[model samples]
Target: MSDEATGQDPAVEDRFETGPIRPPSEAGSYLLRLTRGCPWNRCRFCRTYKRRKFSLRTVEEIEADIDAMARIRDRLAPAGVAGGPRAAVRRGVVTNDYEWMVANALASGGRTAFLQDADSLVMKPDQVRRVLAHFRERFPEVERITTYARSRTVARLSVDDLRSYGEHGLNRIHIGMETGHDPLLELIKKGATAELHVKAGRKVKEAGLELSEYVIPGLGGREMSEGHALDSARVLNAIDPDFIRLRTLTLGPKIPLWEAFHGPEAVLTRQDDAEIAAEIRRFIEALEGIHSRVVSDHIMNLLGDVEGCLPDGKADLLARCDAFLDLPEGDRRLYQVARRAGLVNGPADLSDPGVRARAEAVLAEVVRTYGPGRIEEACRDMMLRFV
Candidate 1:
């Protein structure tokens, strides 16, 4: 039914906008589009904002979106005391996309919000402040607001500006420090140097904001894997971000990085699950003097259990990687197929009779489809689906 028929304002639905992606941790947060696309979308491995023009939404436009969200929240507020907004959605009372967005957030407790496009900090500090102020005014219940930012952009901002943003309710910043190795950074066209990453990360921490630094295992392929691991640890140790997220690399034909993996002049070679496991082990072993919690929250990762607080849990994190690495060839291949197929979480799951049987079944199917020697290739094919 139409908005008019449902007694809902059409303008409220029209003004709401969202971006393409958010961190896996922000699944429950209300996504607010502060920008249309990534300001710096040149990274070879990224296809998130490809072919899309980048533009910032004006403060007035952002306020309008917040106001629309507020209208939906008010409509759904009474529903929360009963069956909740999800029930209202099922009854067709929350029929529109905008209403559904608000409903999902309300269902998740409406305690967090994530600003979108890829680089929200690229906007003027004062403009971002205004948007945050309006959002807080509308949703004072929100406890946290986070956004993705480029190291180059964050480095450009002063500590005072970052602190001011924190004071205005933007509490967390997620930076994609894919690899701290300078050569790997240039090869990926990340548009930021190792120095810039450190500078930006330190500034965010210094400003009293929670920081999540994302690192991609196997980002350097086999050629620079060692440098990738050590340098990434070095950078993280210097910054000591609140979270160190592990997002293993998953490349396909759609991304520009795929070309680097093929051809006679190929400078990069893709790493299989086993190689990535070893690299992650090295990366974890090198981390020192930091208290960041390591997180492997993404499906792209081969080992979901390789997560823990640093310093104390460091050995445990390495042992998780070692457990996978220590497995025999057949067992490793079996676990890889099972993990990529979403049949198991880690190598430990294979010890369970039911899980082992399921994993064996998945391994047999993968070998049957792709041939025995091509198990890694089949796993890659499966991992690309998540990407």
Candidate 2:
């Protein structure tokens, strides 16, 4: 009898289910989901997994999935074959999860994996350790593993727990710390206080784990822009995380925050591109005595060209920001139009006559369709797609 006919279970394959998103840096890493959704899904600006329910997978189930992944990895290994590349064609092995996993593993140099769902760090310390141990055992080649975390959750973990996590190979934690201004945090319903963010960041660093804090540039909008930048810098300077990533706010229509932003009594007034650039400039200026690397990895930022190590690269980053801010209004508008459309990456492109001409033509067309004043708003609307 076949294995299926004898009351024995058939061998499982492709049991893994990835969540909706992961960090841009994790594009080349294998996605392993230990949780189903965000445990605290109240952040107004975020829409990821909002429509889904949060549930943690049991240790047994997660181990089974890991075992399945290991089997696939071994089968997909690029080793000796009789007929070279043609052997794969003869075997009729079409690309699926196994093939994609192998491709990503090769792309990552066989060194990294990213745990998925919004807050995998919220898992119980013992449970997380088991998962980490299983990963290390199965994929001994992987050198780094990362996950998103909530500040309050990290703060709640005891020092011993965090230390064990590090020892078990939890190398990095990425936290979406939208803003450090308490009032804005409350307004945006971030659920965690600025003090909690500081504590959590310090805890991660103390455990010898690298921390990446995601900062939403226009999160506080116009009213709190100054305080947002200054206080954010203050908190970051206090903890000095390994990376400060730029994720400028783009008010998506589906998000609850959009209603608050568009309402007449709205407390938050969205900042235009130029205004946001100025705010980021102030934020960078306020950072002091920290060794964090500031990254403008997303296109929503008005100045994608701005990035460098703090203290050492401060002046250069500031100059890059000013390079865009000081441009002629028409030129700035053109750059903004091109940047959002994926036509240009940053300020460096403005120097190229071909890029300038293309952006100018696009801006002219936009101006014809909508008035001159609508250019910024139109670009903002396009930016929502990235969110």
Candidate 3:
């Protein structure tokens, strides 16, 4: 662990899950990479950040990154404050979470910081605190900090340590909850169970820091898709985090799932993404009480763009899914084309007849070029994401 204050490397540093979080007030938010990759990278259905190894970055390294961001924040500071720049800086300094911290830091002449690697929290609490303090002391303007944490790490930690970090302005955490089904988790070699996921989520909530949970559709596959939906719902229902981000399963090279599919005689035939849509529909329908905002921001998900207030927009969301299902098979293929092109994902609108026709046209070419068997090939490629 390199102490930023002393310019010495700590024995270890922070790591991050390979993703970013966007806040509504994202103008000031910073993406702190706290974890390197998924510690349990063996999941059959996952590919995001799986190619990387897990590591803890040094405190100095993380602080240095923050210091680099401080310059930008400093320049923007004068604009956001209502009163004079001094007042702006003062208010910005007190915000405990990262966005506020960075924004405030910019206003206050402090730097905003984002943690790196995978599990930053894996560092000793005192070490993390020192890093935060050094940032605080040196920047005096950085008011907030954030990092990613695994359920297992959160569960293993004593709450006081967490509370201390929060007090130090280590403000937000993102948890990857791909699916909550225990059997599915087992299939994927996810390190934590549904219970641990909740325990970690609630602990973050209890600590008074912001939390975002990620869920990936189709990880359970058609065989266990229903269980994936219901069981994942069960897990989220317990935590009810600030956000439940959507990440649909997409394939890449070297993912273990592809190996499984090819190995022991490829038992699972690829679903036409209609199954992916169905899985999303089921997931939305199953969600219950708790004010959680669902987000489908990634291109890999069939409903990658579909998300809204849960259980309330649930009806409309499902209706959208039904509409997609109603399209002619050719039109459905169009939507799939759009999905691959990153033009469309999610249960959102693909109503433009032209877009659908275009999708169909594209699918025709794809089929002509690669054959229908290519879907399986694509799925296999997606599964290789971990390697």
Considering every candidate listed, which one attains the maximal lDDT? 1
Which tens-of-lDDT digit does each residue in 154-188 have in candidate 2? 99998789889889988999998889999999988
Q: TM-score ranking from best to worst? A: 1, 2, 3
Model 3: residues >4 Å from true position, as ranges? 1-54, 68-113, 136-145, 265-270, 345-349, 353-361, 371-387
Alpha carbon deviation, residue 144, candidate 1 (Å):
0.6
- Residue 267 displacement in candidate 3 (angstroms): 6.5
**How close is each model in CA RMSD to the real structure?**
2.8, 5.3, 8.4
Instruction: Quantify how close model 2 is to the true structure by its C-alpha RMSD in Å.
Output: 5.3
Pull out the clashing pairs in model 2. Answer: none
Estimate every model's Cα lDDT from 0 to 1. 0.89, 0.83, 0.64
> TM-scores of the models, in the given order?
0.95, 0.91, 0.73
Estimate the overall C-alpha local distance difference test score of candidate 1. Answer: 0.89
Q: How badly does each model clash, as a count of residue pairs?
A: 0, 0, 43
RMSD (Cα, Å) of candidate 1?
A: 2.8
Better of 1 and 2 by lDDT: 1
Q: How displaced is residue 299 in candidate 2, in Å? A: 2.3
